[model samples]
Target: MWIHKSRNPNQNFKRGGCMFSIFLWEEKDVQRGLFKMTCFSAVEPKQLGVILKDMQRIKDGYAWFLDGCVFCIQPFQNQSRYSLKGYRIFFNTSIETGMYLYDITLGLLGGQISGIECVIKCPSKKSSDWISGLRSDTSFQMTDPRGLFNKNGCGIIVVNDTVILQMRNRNKLKVYEALKKIDSIREELLSSVEYDLFSCSKEAG
Candidate 1:
């Protein structure tokens, strides 16, 4: 489970606001890593709602939540990139807590709620590249090849195929609970894996 805390929540965090902005990638490698980062800035809440309503008219594409200040690092490689790869649209929702902080991803498809899944790369020492253990009852996809590492030593590659988030938030307290639940489920999956990528590497040596 990766938890990101914002230094200034209001400045950096914007949830479901309007003033539509589309960011295009200018740099090659930077664009490849852009999905792991959420860069949407503040906008008007009503404007955000209008955009969502318009989106519902579209028959295709995926919908998901993008919690500010939290993200998962993961590997990306597709054998068939030009094919019918799914398109995803995400919204930001910040669930702040005093002790713990993170964001939860809620997925929707064809105007109906669907399951949530996240695949991210972590340090071999901090997490294992093996993610079959995190599989939920629902169908999911993962790809962790043999040799891959970032500049940082963190390169294990973890994923959460379980843990669905309910969009029921009456107040700040409820939001906090929802965020905590999401984080806890991630922790459970990481702990249950029981093996780190480096451990296998050490044995191979």
Candidate 2:
């Protein structure tokens, strides 16, 4: 969507009002090691030892919240260029707290709503590369290496059948309760007085 605002002007271009809204949908990386950051990031770790014992579960070199579910984390190395590592989760059920991942590959248990589909390169001390996305139970398609899948498919980066499934299934209220802390940030912009509607009206009168 292009906006035109020129009278033999500066390249005959200007940003429209809606372009500012695009930032709301921008994908932001929420790595685990950067823990005090992004209160908006969500994850349902399958490591009970981390949640129950008040410990941190490290995956792909980052810390994630553990409730109770089973998942697997493997170093993603498929393409000829990048040797990135990622993990996949098989949810028995979903609590729907809205998780964020680089790309989530699901099994028969749970799924994602609208999540980040790209993978991230994490150079941390716990895990290699990390992938995160939204957590919803919609039964999306994951990549089937066997080439025996239906219409609804998901693309997965399988290294070995070494896909270690992990878990942290927990109370739904608790997850949502924690997420409430994350708030939407608002931004403001300014325009010159020459374009001010109020000033223009006053000057014309």
Best by lDDT: 1
The candidate that wins on TM-score is: 1
Against the true structure, candidate 1 reaches a TM-score of 0.27
What is candidate 1's local distance difference test score? 0.27
Clashing pairs in 1: 73-120, 73-121, 74-120, 74-121, 122-156, 123-154, 123-155
Q: 1-205 in candidate 2: lDDT tens per residue?
A: 1122221111111121212110111111211100111111122433323432322233322222333221222222222233222233211112232233212222211322222121211222112111111111123233443321111222323121111111122222232323222110000001211234457689999
> In model 2, where is the ten-residue run with the lowest total lDDT?
182-191
RMSD of each: 14.9, 23.3
Candidate 2 ranges with C-alpha deviation above 4 Å: 1-59, 70-95, 98-147, 153-205
